[model samples]
Target: MAWNTLTCAALARNASRRLHHRALSTHPNPRPYTFHIGASWAGKPNEPHQRPKVPWPADGLIGSWRDRTLARPNRTTTSKDAGEDFFFIQEMRNQSILEGVSFGVADGVGGWVDSGVDPSLFSQALMYHSHRYSRNAWAGEPEIDPTLDYEEREQIEGWEMTPYECLDLAYGGVLREKFVQAGSSTACIISLNASSGLLRSANLGDSGFLIIRSSAVHYRQRAQTHFFNCPKQLTKLPANSGRRFSRACIDSPSEADVFETKLRDGDIVIAYTDGLSDNVFPSEMVTICSLVARAGGTEEEQVQAIADRIVEYARQCMKNKNRVSPFERDAARQGMFFRGGKPDDVTVVVAIVHETS
Candidate 1:
């Protein structure tokens, strides 16, 4: 397939300019803010052309989570083409004035052999269901203690209800009815309660969630991926009965695994599809967050800027392949997944958490 240099250039340009604006926005009122969330996506050319159909509901102080989807070159000769990978962020309301949660999910390209199911449907189902579950979980729970240390309090509150169980219920019922008959997907979720200064997160597949606190980076994996199979833990689940259990058996150990952390005044929690994490390094992520923090902008703006830089960095990495080391190949492959002659889709969602004095 002939490479479309023009299209690649346009993609890179649009992403970079987006970062510039996000990085430069002025800080909004920091009064014990409720929450801020942002989401972005890119589609692979080989997959079916399904546009993201999730709704962006505006709540309290949380800004509207914006959406972006881009198309890439096709990989196969068949009339059924694959598109770019999709990435998205959904920032849900902090159940109480004291807590907030944000998450991002990415679906792998379904065109590849053994990719299992169509990623579009898988990603959509996971995001839609997970968000609904979080909302319900928050509603059923009692008010969180404002006096406890943020992280400690979260552990206490998180235990009362299981986000993973909520996820399981969502997945087992409607989500399964609609998509599981075909296949399953990898999913990760992250939540933060500001007043309590606690963070809760969870994952079920390769899609990852990370938290950057005071220059330290923490990585969380939702589900493990084998060369051609699902994680062992998942396959053993009782739900594995004759199902396409490739990725679903490895049940997330409770949302706590994905939801651990205490927020300082300037912590950044990022939930993203593999497209961004696959391409960018942990150190690079820290650098992007630090730049945003130092530059000074609203949490939403800083997140957008960081995400934009990540896309630009991926494009640059593609152009400078000769400089990449063999040891770095594994890391570089993440970024390359979205580039090259036949690139996969790429998507990222960034959320910055700030403490209100």
Candidate 2:
């Protein structure tokens, strides 16, 4: 497949500019913010309803989070086929019990750009709906039964709706009439119930999330791919005209693996797309998280630094073609041979738990 060279040296330069220009806030309840790399939607924003902005700190043990994403190095944002990645974080209302914070990352498959549909829309739409469903599902849940034990509580807390249900809802948003081109994307979502100390996650593709404690990996989502360059995804149905589509199109929600874990104070959770995960190895990720965990600064500053450093590392991997990816290293460890890194959109979210056990 041929790839276009981006004019954005303009793009690359702009990314550098944004990173330096980011404002720093030291106040306890610094404002919450969101950002994206690659192309923005052409029409009205495909985002889920926007909520009123309020003074909120990006960190706290109960829930503090920050995120960032960047196009593959040397890629131009103006290209239709440039990084097609999107992410979101939904903050809970003051007294919500069922859902405290929700976050997600999605990678829009590049193949769909030829079909006249901007693949970013597919990803952004999925994340928008997933964000909405996460909150609504929690709001609609039955009141917790105080009689339940810890095991029962953990199970029941995440049982209101399956991950697949959230995927389907995101799919519906993608297929809405305003958007006509058929497309597909991979998504991973994580939601936290601060009061119960439960962190629930689900994913439908290579995009994944992880939990880190004491400079070690507490948990990391496994990548689900049919093979290289072919991640499992939620796809669009063909129109009645019976047009042909890629054989990879299964046209259904991919199975979403779910994980639930209890977070303790100072644990760091990270979610990222394949650009970072596929290029950097697990041990490398641990080192990056550990540095952030130990970094001296406000929690918000450290989290931002973590996102910046990881994306920078992924960019370095892309530029140094001879660098063997973690994937290749694993294959070599297993007595098979593989090599090199992948150049693609990289997105990451860093969240720090504030409450002590």
- Measured by TM-score, the strongest candidate is 2
TM-score of each: 0.61, 0.68
Full-model lDDT for every candidate = 0.46, 0.58
> Which window of ten consecutive residues has the lowest lDDT sum in model 1?
16-25
The lowest-lDDT stretch of 10 consecutive residues in candidate 2 is 36-45
Model 2 misplaced stretches (Cα beyond 4 Å): 1-82, 94-99, 135-164, 241-243, 327-339
Cα RMSDs, all models: 9.6, 11.4
Residue 289 deviation, candidate 1, in Å? 2.3
lDDT per residue, candidate 2, 1-357, as tens digits?
Answer: 111123212222333322111112453443232211111211111222221133113353111321122232222223322246777666443333323566778888877755556676567667766665554554123354659642354344233544555566667766773443556888887766545557777787889988888888888888887766578888775576364663755645647787787777777778888777877777776776565445455554455556656666675675565888876775677687766865667777767666622
* Shift in Å, residue 104, candidate 1: 3.3
Per-residue lDDT over 258-327 for candidate 1, one digit per residue giving the tens place of the 0 to 100 score: 3455567666666665555555567877876676556665555556656655554543443444544322
The lDDT, on a scale of 0 to 1, for candidate 1 is: 0.46
